[model samples]
Target: MRPNYLVIILLIFYSCNKIETRDEVYPTKLYEKAKYFQNENISDSAFYYFNLAKNDYVKINDSTGASKSLVNMAIIQCNNGDFYGSIETSLEADKLLRNESDSTVKSTLAANYNNMAISSSFLKNYEESVAYYKKTLQFSNDAENRYIYNNNIGDALILLGQYKEAKKYLELAIFTKDSLIYAKVLNNIARAKFLDDQNYNPLPELNKALIIRQNNKDIEGQNSSFSTLADYYLEKNAEKSLLYSYKLLETSEKIKKPEDQINALQRLIMLDKPNYLKYFKRLTAINDSTQTSRNKAKNQFAVIRYDVEQKDAENKNLKLRDAENEINIIYLSFGLGILIITLIIGHFWNEKRKKSIKIEKEKEKELEVKNTELRYSKKVHDKVANKVYHVMSELENTENMNKEVLLYKLDGIYQISRDISYDKNDVALEHNFSQHLSQMLKSYSSENIKVPIIGNEESLWEDVGDHSKVEVFYILQELMTNMKKHSKADKVLLDFSRENDLINIVYSDNGIGISEFSPKNGIQNTESRINSIGGTINFDTKTENGLKITLSFPAKN
Candidate 1:
């Protein structure tokens, strides 16, 4: 066993959480005094001081302190026999401590759950006891806590008549270094085994555990052993069972354990038929007293928390009203200042601003008309004029090209010109773009003009955006239109290559390079496209053989 294992065992099994209190603070002082009363076994005074401390913690918005105080009050409530009230108080503490994971907060939470589990066990809510015990294990840092919690869960399961499942946990709980723990496990294990199979012998284990508890003078252990043994021999040896019952009653009364007293009286009522009525009367009196005490304890705990809640609710209402009044005053002042500013600004500059806006609108209207005319002119020349010239070259080149193919091309050109004003692009130029581009460049080829395109692989179009591809298509189409009309170039070469995300195009011809280097509207339209894609264009008309136009742009939009 590790050094701190005992400390952890004490913390878990005995619920010994170290109270941290600051003497300088009144709330902490109250908490310290509450701890003193709690240690002295003055529960009502402890509950009073803890309630005061909780309200103080709430006033300061110290949720951790408030939750810790509540956990302490809940334990006191459970010890006072208010099981249901303890469960409610522990749940309230858990709400305050939710989403907190620091070590101290976790420790407080573990204590909170352990209290609930104990209260649940007392309430005969074995299922709830098992559930809360498992939840307690989840927060406990000590691995050795498994022995304690697993045994508790097993005990609950035994009462639930889940004997087979009960033994599984009890088997793991035989950590023998702790004698009381081992004896507790041994008693429960024998009970579970005997309950599971009537023919199974439990006396050896049962007597062994009873002897260990007797030697240790463990009052709770002795009570458990006394009850188990009396029940086991109730039919077999009534005299022996009655002896354990009298011992149980004597010990229970000496220790002020009313629950154990009730159990012992019931056994005596059944085994001692001659004195049955006397034991039954005693049983009735003790039962009434225990019930009255439990009820009083429950009411006391509830009323304390309820009073705090009522005061806190009233405080919230008062704060909300004060905040509302301050907000209304601020809003009134802000409204008046905004109204004055609005009137002054409206009187001084409203007409001048209106006049300025009208002049700007008129200028924008004029520029929009000019831009519209320029776009229309460019689209018509690019989509109509260039397309018609390319068709003319196709007709002149093909010996017997069918009229249907010719009509389709002309109809496509017609639709483009018709929708040119509304259309932002020539739809889907990126579909099989490489093959389409190759076909378009080579279409301008005739017997005299050998236009060979290089590096027109399909993969070059991989990362290129649709809009950029459309612009590049238009630029190339405009260049081809000019080459066919004016450049008078033969044996034109179009080279394409890619560097990372950039596309590079090189165009050259063997004949008739431009001398003056002047570009018309079609050439200017190509220049605009190059600039639009944020690319560079270089026209080397002074090249030895022909005009060399080089361009580079981003492959993606």
Candidate 2:
């Protein structure tokens, strides 16, 4: 007969209700697979699948499914001899259960608590086990469950030396018509009566239960009956006690329960002195190995749970990163769409204004030919032409142009064209030059492309002249646009460094190199602007892997 510690493990699985899964695959399939393995006695595989099912249930917000899976996992742990781990796992299931719930959930909650009680009993925490059995009864609505919990509570109370209270619950348990359950309770009642009052004769009830257990072929029940009878006869009849003790040890070994075998050996060592040394050695051996088995069980279960937790955390982190990346892509695309629309409208409006000015000038030339020609030429060059050409050039160069900047430039041109004599030379000085440079390079990034910037801190640009900053800004801007348009590149990197009074930038892209480099703007604009700021630009067009352009310039005048 297995120890009563194994009794609760049986109690739970027999009575617990499985959560009904109506065709949904994810959690339901996992639950089914776990059940198949559990029924097949593949405990490790069962625990693994049940844990997976619990995680899946949590993801879908099915509290009932998660609780059921946890309960089953706890039972598996109990069966595997990991009593502490079993109690911990059962508590996890309890957290998922509600205090007041539907009948099915109530039944689940009862079974979960019952598992805790059984595992606690095995660990010799009888007070805690009694408390847990009472909790199990609290959720139980079924009369059969009431009987079961009563018997369990009685068993634990007997362990605590409360024989009178143990008999009270055992009497309630004996009211059941179940012959097997009746036999179990009858033995407990007999043990309690004899324990509480040494004068009380329990042989009749004990013998009757033993007969019923034998008739039913209840091996665990017979194991209990043998133990109870042997203890009862130990003080009164030495010969009968020795006979029952031998039977207990034989039956315990047949069932292969180390705890029961230990109990039986203990009785024999006390009763039969001839083989005391032999029985003592076997008892010691089993005791040592039992603890080893328990520790091994605890470690194996702990490792399995720990590994699953780590994998779940990794999966969640990966999902969170994916979600964030998707959101960024959406924002970038939306901003790009708005920018393109603004540029299109701005371009058409500017073209219309320039056309209107030329027509007016032509009409005036017919009336005051010489005067209008001179006035028209001066006004168009000074106000209408330069400011409009500036706006158009800025529009052409900047793709992700800021709305406020575009609006400011257009308003400047509008006012300048109206005054025709306000020649305000805009230097385009920016206080936060480093930030602007960083944003410009990063704006080119897409889902398929990565733009990583390095060492472009504000401190690096501190001593740089405004003319140099502005020229470098546009120079870098041109390179980015050029790469996007023709490089077919997937990666772009800009590494910046400084040496005392000079700032150096090396721009690279993993794209088809300068063999396909078609330089537009015959003016050599990049070279001219670099030289104006005491800067030199070098292009390595020989590499096949990508483009590497190095620009070195004095940080200050």
Candidate 3:
């Protein structure tokens, strides 16, 4: 009895193991069933089984198997006119097979690219389709796939109006040993030639392709050949065109491709047959049905993708919420510790901030006092010292004392001192600044010297601030004094212009320029005044060319 019980137990364990093994192999069986249905042209069943296989493979983490199913599903989706869905599925397969090394895996990768090319072509994305076909060529080591991809790329180029480029790839496909592929390439080349020039006859190549398709019993190829021949003969030979168009319609219906059937029916309608209205009605019906099916398929695909993305987002949100809860607990604990430390450090930081503020205020006060002293010194130097120096020079040069000239000089000095004391040195601001500036320039002119002023419109000085006006007046005075005393300039040009918010002044003189001179008191004073007004001055000097100075500043209103 014990021996019998052991045998029963061992049998039950073996049965359980066998069931587990069968479960493990189920995805491969599902993939095979999908392939069988796809070959039979039962697309609905094929899609159902392919999805099943894909989900099963994904459950087992079998990426290669899932990719294979996905590629096939993408092809079916493309045929059903779900081009956007097909593209997404093909990209998913491409990601899975990116690092695969097996020869079969490589073939699948090539097929994935080819499927993407076909889908893009149907969507009228000719350039992207051509790019995907080229990618297909890169992975396609087999001659069959290479020839097919070359032909597909060439056809897409022809559609894009690149007949010359299309001929090159078509010729490559023509080199294949497969007669069917060679015939297809020849037909495409002939069509490209005919389209490029209507005078070219494509009938010879069409006849050759037709013969090959008929011999091979390839219904789809026959349909394509008949359609091309019918279009080629439509204007030249109406009867022959009608016969081929009818043949194309028959073959298309036999192949059960609604798009092809509608195309053939439309061609027949264009032939002006006795039953033209009948063909037109049939064409309309088939076209409407085809469009409806495509729209339904696209909608279905979109719904499925939306649902998948939504579920994925929901799952991600759940995971993030769980992680956030755990992190919040840790952060709360850490925050309490950080808060205590921050309170301790903040007290010290507050004391340091107060000390820093006090030091900054002291520095600011010192800067203000120094600035006040500098302003007083500049006023005395410009107003008192300069006038005193001129008086002393006049006294030394004169042998007899001229009371009127001395009194006139003394009165000018007293007025200048009063202007400096009141900080109202800009006499030009009392009248038109441009006219005053012109009068000042004329003062620097003599029998041997010429001063040409240009672009000095009164409007240009309208935006000058009071302080900037005073500084500018002093700067010009210093420059003219330097030129009169040292430059020996015969001609001077002063141009002033306002652009946007900036005032530009160009001062140039033809003089016996200094070879290399340091800044004298006059030049130093000019620079200081310009700096006080926030203006820039640049000097261009050469012994032969004299000196040119450009000054610019932001116009202050």
Give the clash count for each candidate. 0, 0, 0
Q: List the global CA lDDT of all models.
A: 0.85, 0.82, 0.81
Clashing pairs in model 1, backbone N/Cα/C closer than 3 A = none
Strongest candidate by lDDT: 1
For candidate 1, lDDT tens digit of each residue in 1-557? 23235334443443222223323347998999999999999998899889889888987888988999999999999999988778888999999997557888888888898899999999898888899888888888875676888899899999999999999999989865798899999999999999999999999999999899999999889999999989988888999999999999999999999999999999999889999999999999999999999888887777776786788789779856865665555446556665666677676678888899999999999999998898789788877888888888888878898999999999989888878878765653735888888778887888888888899898898978777787788888877777887777778889999966889999888768877688878788888888888898889977667688998999876
Worst 10 residues of 3 by lDDT: 1-10
Q: What are the TM-scores, per candidate, against the unseen true structure?
A: 0.52, 0.55, 0.49
Q: Which pairs of residues collide in candidate 3?
A: none
Q: Tell me how candidate 1 scores on lDDT.
A: 0.85
lDDT of 1 at 250: 93
Model 1 off-target regions past 4 Å? 1-26, 306-557
lDDT of 2 by residue, 1-557 (tens): 12223434543443343224333449889999999999999988899889989998998888889999999999999998999899999999988887466887898998998999999999999999999999899898888779888998998999899999998899999898789888888888888898999888888999999999999988888989998888888888989988998998898889998988999999989888999999999999999998888878777777777788999999879856865665455446555655666678778878998999999889777768765564445445434544565556466656889999989988977776765544343223445678877876777777777999999999998878777887787677667767776788999999999966889999999998877445554115566668889999988888889999999999996
lDDT of 3: 0.81
Candidate 3 per-residue lDDT, tens place, 1-557, comes to: 33335445655675566568753548888889989999998876787678778877887888888999999989989988888889999998888896657887888898998999999998899999999999889888988778888999999999999998998899888888898888789889998899888898888888998899899998998988988898888889998988988898998899888877887888888886788999988988887888889888877655555565576578769856865675555446556665666678788889999999999999999999998887877777765765576576457656797899899989988888777657674565667777876876667676677888898887888768877876776677667656766787889888888756789888888887766757866677778888878889877765377788888887883
User: What C-alpha lDDT, on a 0 to 100 scale, does residue 131 get in candidate 2?
Assistant: 96
**Model 1 Cα shift for residue 229 (angstroms):** 0.2
lDDT of 2: 0.82
